[model samples]
Target: MINYNNFIRALIIKNKDIVTAIVFMAIIAYVLPYYTVGGQGANAPSDGQSVGGGGAGGGGGGAGVTGVPIHVVQRTVFQRPYELLPCTQSVVELKKDLIPTTDFPSLVNETVSKFKVTVLNVYNTPDYKAMLLAEGDEKKVLQDPHFLPASATCGEMILELLPSLVPVTNIYDVANQVVSTYHVKVVDVYNMTDYKAIVILAEPDNAITKDSRFINYNQNNTLSSNYTGSGELDLSSGHIAAPAPVLKEETLPDSIKRTFTTEDLKGNAKSNFSKGVDADIAILDTGIDLNHPDLNVYRNVSFIPGGKTGDDDNGHGTHVAGIAAAKDNGKGVIGAAPGARLWSVKVCDKAGECKVSDMIKGIEYITQHADEIDVVNISVETPLSPALNRAISASVKAGVTYVVAAGNYGHDASTTSPASDPDVMTVSAIADSDGKCGGTGPALKAHNVTDDSFAHFSNFGPSVAIAAPGVDILSTYLKGGYAIDSGTSMAAPSVAGAAALIKAGDPNMSPEGVKKALLGTGSTPLTPCEGGPQGYFTGDPDQYKEPLLFRKLGAK
Candidate 1:
């Protein structure tokens, strides 16, 4: 009624003007070369030179600094090689269908024929199904739509995708892009939580874009960085550097006398109260020495394919195993839980390198066989991985208690993985070279420079649940021998062995109950080492240090 047509004409003219201005601005922006300030880019000069014409004085006058032509080297993107899980090729878990026996095989065969994917073997359980498929000529099973069973619902299939040849600068950004663009879904990013940079997968179609800046794929893949060797306790170097003394069969070990005797655990061992007789404890580390005299290794299995034996080529696992459950016979050393059945689940290689996928496989195996296992001892530490965390959490739900190391960097334990994760009990190292128990029966004593103190290399913080003997601790080594090493690695197994004892004491106790019994009863407060490495002491000793691991269980 009030000049509607006139108003509409005015609006159209106004919109046209706005569009013209926007178009003009866009054109200007497109013509101009973008410049970044003091950063790596196409326009940014690699050498230290001003972008503007570089002359000292007046405009276009006198000798000017000649600009060198920048030669940009094109980065090469390598295709990553993925390792298929052995025995069973891919695992699929069904959500709705419990009866996989009837529906799964036909669905798998139909899908395989449809996609021309080859099948080798098939294994099925109540909850999940595993298909052993042949590796295709292209080695990209994930790219095939028929690879996953149509009948299966939500499930995970394991695959190990090697690290890219080039370094992945930003893991989160790259990982996000990879999931969004590629045909595969990334389940876990290895060492992304720490310093080791590798990626893990549930199922991956290697259909990565050729121009992808992130995601390194090297045929001959080495570690992104040098292996830190699990934790700060490198036997070859650092604080605890002395060579391990060779002990005769008749010689009694000091670690047994100090830890067990000091903690009043000798009574339990003598009475056979909590020796972890029927409990199964898995050691997920470098393979164990199968023939160690003091060790009672029940089964040895390796997760690394092409490397089938679970022998301790690297000495760390052997040492950790001995500390957890060496035999109690009148020989070299007795462990915390002397009667526990030991399962050597080798996750790391001979070079002490562990991939995230290998670790997940080992954990999945434990989860699958959770009924038989009661406790798991993980002496290795890495950055937090989502997939690894999920596997561990799943295992925990399946009733397996995980005991992990707090790391040896002598900083905050809260920053490291497994230790950082709340599900697991994180153990810090206490320097008790003399084997004397500090503090009165229930009261915590003040700082004792000559007595027990926190290890200079042990990590501390809120994540630490308890402390154990780790400094110069003697335990079993590789090649049927023994060695003395110190680290939170050593401390973790002491707690693991204690967990086995606790489980043996009360077979019905849950992981939380066991953790409570261990932390709540520990009375010995750790004192800071007076003069060791700089920045080792976290200002408040009482707040940072955890209580010592006491052997007296059922004390409420």
Candidate 2:
């Protein structure tokens, strides 16, 4: 056989490399069962728990079986924690035209779609901040993912849902998500067919402002009642005085004032109309004193936080209530429409300060009761707020007339809200000392306005739809007493009462119809002044004049 040992040696040498490869593969296969990248091993994720945390675009590693190391790569994707994710994208895009585009950062990574889809499952989590805190990197948490930095929330805001989100479920779903994602509390929620919004209370300088969807949401500002007197008059036990100023100025005859006629007990022909019967007027202000006997407060609600009953601790609402519809009960003071039912909507605190969101809440409350409520008296003044304006417009569309105070700053009424809004009936103030239209009455020099003329403190502009007696106005007060106050605040309620009277005449009258009736039947109180030919008031800055409010509309 020839060289058998040499043949065997050559075969062994040639197969040496293949034998070593097989052995290494066997070792790898055995180790994989207990150790793999980011898998269970001596030091890796165990029972679905993460090992170490990483900063943005960082990685971590742990020991594997036999002291070998296994490296794991952390995700590099970053996104706005409050951004609308892919789950809601399709639905949002369907109404893209209706939704305003928020200025959010562009997704830089091409892999963001996959990461966003993964985050959607955890989107409804109760607290993202807590989750990030557990990651043990507060600073990196702000930059990596899950929350906006503390710098994002600049002020308080009201979140407005797209009008197209009319469905209750959809509105709540969006609202809840927003509340959870932003870590903000919903102070109130407003949901109507045409309008949907929520008031979000945030820490100062928070980051929700960075979200594009809330770009239009403005900071919550303080609003206050427009009236200005603090002195109280004691009428607790004395003979309650009739509203002398109001009665003297209201020149409407009986025939014009009567809304319904019926036979008396003596079978004599008589009109039974007590004034504002069957009409409801909601006073949005500091609460009204419910115990005032002269007032026929039908119902009351408080929009102030932690407030229970709508009771006036501040007396402004009571004064306004008295001006609007105290009662014809021959006590305290008679209001413009004394027989009308009154509803106190307390939007302000005991200090007479209210938030813009609270005002919106008050309007929504009135709107919900629109079928029963005929008129709304808003004597508060605020800065120009688009959200407040929208709320008023929604209420007007619901068929309730809105009477707002023009303002007391003596500036352009157009600079304020609700007064500037086109849908509302803006009332300016006139100082009617003698209750007559002629400017012949002695000037109330101390109060800074002449009688039968535009009040020196009243805001004047073309937006003023009507004028009413505002200076030195006598009205019911808290603790079953009476008080004298002045401002466009006092004037607004007079028109509100007139609106109630108009609505009472024809319960089915539209808000516009009621407004038209008041405008059509108003008197020219300034006609007897020096500018009588122009119909403008004495102290008014504008050349154009608004008719003085006269509630009398002769028989239908």
Candidate 3:
């Protein structure tokens, strides 16, 4: 049977932060139904400073909002590299190509037909990972199938192996019994097209093997797989993801509502602006929570039917919405853009993903409704698809100041979806290097000087536009109350809020002008990021030191 839980744990939170990994550790696989993995992973410790208690990964949530330390996972796969033909062979002449011609293993299989089909290679640039995804006719493939590990997944993030490898006649002659080889086809995640591939593998007897070879795109990483009990084969992993979710405290340094309450509303977002003036922050996500007391005023806004509409099913959208525009009533927490309005168009689901179809719907919503929203904040990402790009281009043309997360995947120059889509301001997270890493527990202070420092979890690249407060941010959650979370997801909105403050000051500013103002005005931290692996960090802090972009962008 196909194990879906392992696939979700490995893929969704695979290579990101430690929180998700910790979840994998604590949250047992709900198998017996469809998943089969045991509940023996890792869990986060409730103790202080004890971050990495899970399997092997944990996101560094430093005390202050400085550059928090983070670690990335290494995934190496063992497999024989299949090269496309200049050396051609036919299925009728099948019996070959299994073992190396020179003292290799044996190659045998009774089933044989056409040895080749088509393939699609999809890549997650931020994660430095790629999969050869393809789908084909199952019955046809089983006719002359080869015996291997049968596969099934919960989502569409897989690469169909059989179709990509040009078929060899005697590819699996040594199998005890073919078990009536079944041909299964999978979608081509890379191209998102009808690339066909053959499936020749049945469920194994024992999940241990000693003959498998591992393949590394770069040769240094190792792969982990749940199918292999002997731990020979593994899934290609990355870094950064869900953290030990904590109840959020509703106060901070420049907190307009915390230290300064209703009376402070004079200059605060909750008081000054027109009732609906903030209906401009386009929440690019799964949807939002419009019924909440703090957010009821900005309700009834829609982009399209399934278009630019606001209905948050996925927790991410609601969480982000609360961060950008949640009402500041005494009940819930305050928002970054307290005065900002919210427009929603669903793109992701409960599992934190959206079908390409829905994503296109969301982008088109923003483009058509550009005039309605002010600062567009997007906290979603995926492999760069052409269709996705088209949507981004449309939004930019509509003159929206797009802000996106740099992604929590720690690497150099790895930009997430709309962030790397060009013309959008991509933001990174910072860590609190001071001794107060977790001092005073919730009510924290942002060390602006120490912050803006590069975070190990924050993705850096030439495409990274700016940095913001990403690590350990206290924001709104799905059910009701607030929570302490981490990710580039936290950083993007900070800049979006800043951008809104500027755009609100000058309603007629151009997207390019808005960007120049933000980057130009914010104070540059230091030069640690400049020396990063791929020159992904800012080259010099000198520029940021002289002209603080915050002053410029927020200048009324």
lDDT of each: 0.53, 0.54, 0.42
Tens-digit lDDT string for candidate 3 (196-246): 222212122232122222122122223334333221222223334433333
Best-to-worst order by TM-score is 2, 1, 3
True lDDT of residue 499, candidate 2: 87
Candidate 1 ranges beyond 4 A from true positions? 1-258, 261-276, 438-451, 526-542, 553-556
**Which ten-residue region of model 3 has the weakest summed lDDT?**
1-10
**Candidate of highest lDDT:** 2
lDDT (tens digit, per residue) of candidate 2 on 180-290? 666554445777877776654333234544544431333322221111111111111222333112221222211112111111101222223343356899988878889
Model 1 quality (TM-score): 0.50
In model 2, which regions exceed 4 Å deviation? 1-276, 525-536
Please provide TM-scores, in order, for all candidate models, with all chains considered together.
Answer: 0.50, 0.51, 0.47
Model 2 lowest lDDT segment of ten: 1-10
User: What is candidate 2's CA lDDT for residue 170?
Assistant: 60
- Candidate 3 shows a clash count of 75
**Residue 460 of model 1, lDDT score:** 76
lDDT of 2: 0.54
Worst 10 residues of 1 by lDDT: 1-10
